[model samples]
Target: MSASPLKILLCALEPSADALGADLMAALRKRCPEAAFIGCGGALMAAQGLESLFPVDRFSVIGPVAALQALPAALKAADRLADLAEKEKPQTAILIDSWSFSKIAAMRLRKRAPEMRLIKYVAPQVWASRPRRAQKTAELFDGVLCLFGFETGYFEQAGANTRWVGHPGFQAILAHDSDKAAFRARHNIGAGPLLAVLPGSRAAELKRHAAPFRGAIEKLLTDFPDLRVVVSAAPGAENAVRALAAGWPGGAFVVEGEERFEACRAADAALAASGTATAELALLGTPMVVAYKVELLTELWARAVLTTPHVSLVNIAAGREVAPELLQRDCRPERLAAALAPLMRDGPARRSQIEAFPAIARLLAGERSPGDAAAAAVLDWLGTGKTP
Candidate 1:
């Protein structure tokens, strides 16, 4: 008798998915060495043997305005993914991030082939806000592989098979501690307290966050005169971030592209614009203060739709106010400086935050690894009677 092949189709619809998708493919391949991977991804995924139909970056957008602008392209990409699924007819399909687009694509795939098993790598944040979405998971997704443990209950209650698979970013960070001094030396950074500032990854985010962050840096510099600052510029954001902080006193260093993680791991503390970076900073064991500054129009839209008080994942996971969060009107220079100053200076507070890091890691960690667990779940759904 011949052995059956584990045919899997994975869709990566976000920029962050570029890293996470690649990491997942590598992990899945190790466990099920003969499994085949196809569908949408970026450069990293391509390197890991994922056959992509289109560039994931074109579909990786944030904010309502940007989404509206990119909707036509996103719809077309969804159609392309649907076409690939029909032609390929894999045993199971996995969608990673890019919730809006991925959900649409999954719907299309279901319409075409009702028996195909579909799994979502990251669940929507319905627990914090949009509680109704939790009840609607069964409409689109068959299974959900969650990064946070609390997310499982929502999906399970909604009748979707859910798994709390650990986060790949946390796993990557835990594998090795990047040498702080060596990293500093490589960047020509001198002996001084390092403060890493991550404004954001997109153009609109940079516009809202960069100036306010620079303002806070100016205020903090007055108190901590010996402070050294570095801005981890997101990929495709080098020139815009530099322009935003043009007239600063001490100036700042910019680490563009994939080097942002290295800067975060090396910094003493971070004043990051609220998003996934907060979770990344936590895994890197870097104490950070989260802040957000959005356009008036954007704030108005988010205020009406946002479901939770805290925006940082670290606070969401800890189920309390683990770190100070400054958003909207409260994200002023004086306020940010006050919140971050002590986090940079106080040894005990920093240590306490570091001490709580393992618990957060444990909450996000799952069987084998996120990809392997996901792969196993996918294989089980296939009913092939084979181990992953």
Candidate 2:
């Protein structure tokens, strides 16, 4: 009989990738039950039955400064992953996000198993910053799965085998309805125009934003005494955001993990630190002001690399400033107040924002769920012998 079905390696380098990786693995098993999946994932991926070689949390780092500090450990882990891919000789290897390190890991894997197919789950935001990375990605991986519709064109232009697999976040939000009353009751929030504050998920992100976000919280509470401040507490940063908001009049509350989505859905407006949360807020139909803060040196370096005018994915995808963005030094408490006041207060601005939600949702709905589309593309590659 034919040799046992090819072993597929699913490598995840960050926590968020954990969920995406699990979904993909489940789809793969359903599509080809005989195929084996070697797991490189966080807790979520492990729960999906992926054999974990290392914890993904250790590898999660963003921004140039933070990455530099973690470079040694990151390199060691990447090397270990590369060696595993080489020894295993898997038919195909799937590398999820953590673009900075994943790209290097992909290159190393390609060198180790020239015949093995390398699939990149989430293409880097090359269109936003390093457009040249697209060429590098095409050279390193056999195929790429993009989460956004606009990414397909950018990747294809670089001669990469790419597909827009849709953002799983979109599918997730669309599938789940917000339990507004239950959510408010559970959080002990008095319902009167809640303003959700999402500082960001990364530690470095929290350091830069938590303080200013607290200031914004104080300002909102001062101006609108009834405004309930609900913070979407990123995993591991609950206490940090809370500590920063010490001394606030009304006091702030934290919504951890997935509960943050529910809080976002229930909120009338939000002041979000620019990142993935911005997109999440949009999907929840919450009007928001996007802000970002980073180290002075990192910001200076980023200015050289960042090509996009807007950092928030909502604004980037919309091709216009759908939500106001206050970045770096501009992310002051007063300025943040000015930016968010209009979105939260009654008038034409709020109506305009509310009106744009449908179009945004429609744009996000264009692509298939990330897991289904990625699994289908991988299965096709398997059939065509284009991968491995």
User: Residues 1-388, candidate 2, lDDT per residue (tens digit)?
Assistant: 1265868888887767888899998888887788777847887888778778877776677668988998888787778877887888788889998888887777777787777788998888886798998998888888998888777778888889987788776878777777989988886775677888888877778788866777776787767888787778877777876675556554567778778889899888998888778877778888989899888888888899988887888887787888888998889988898778787778887777777876776566544667878889888886785542
Q: Could you list the CA RMSD of all candidates, in the order they appear?
A: 4.1, 3.8
Which regions of candidate 1 fall more than 4 Å away from where they truly are?
Answer: 1-6, 9-90, 185-191, 257-259, 364-368, 384-388
Model 2 stretches astray by more than 4 angstroms? 1-4, 38-90, 184-191, 201-225, 361-368, 385-388
Candidate 1 on 1-388: residue-level lDDT in tens?
Answer: 0265867788886667777788788877877788788888888899999878877676666678988898888888878777877887777788888778777888888887666677788888786678787666667887788888767887888887787877776676667556777888987776677899988877878887866788888898888887888888766778888776566555577786546777887887899988878887887778988998777887888878777777788888877777789998898899998888877876776887888877776665543577776666665656643321
Q: Which ten residues in a row have the lowest lDDT in candidate 1?
A: 379-388
What is the C-alpha local distance difference test score of candidate 2?
0.80
The CA lDDT of each predicted structure is 0.78, 0.80
Q: Estimate each model's TM-score.
A: 0.80, 0.82
What TM-score quantifies how close candidate 2 is to the native fold?
Answer: 0.82
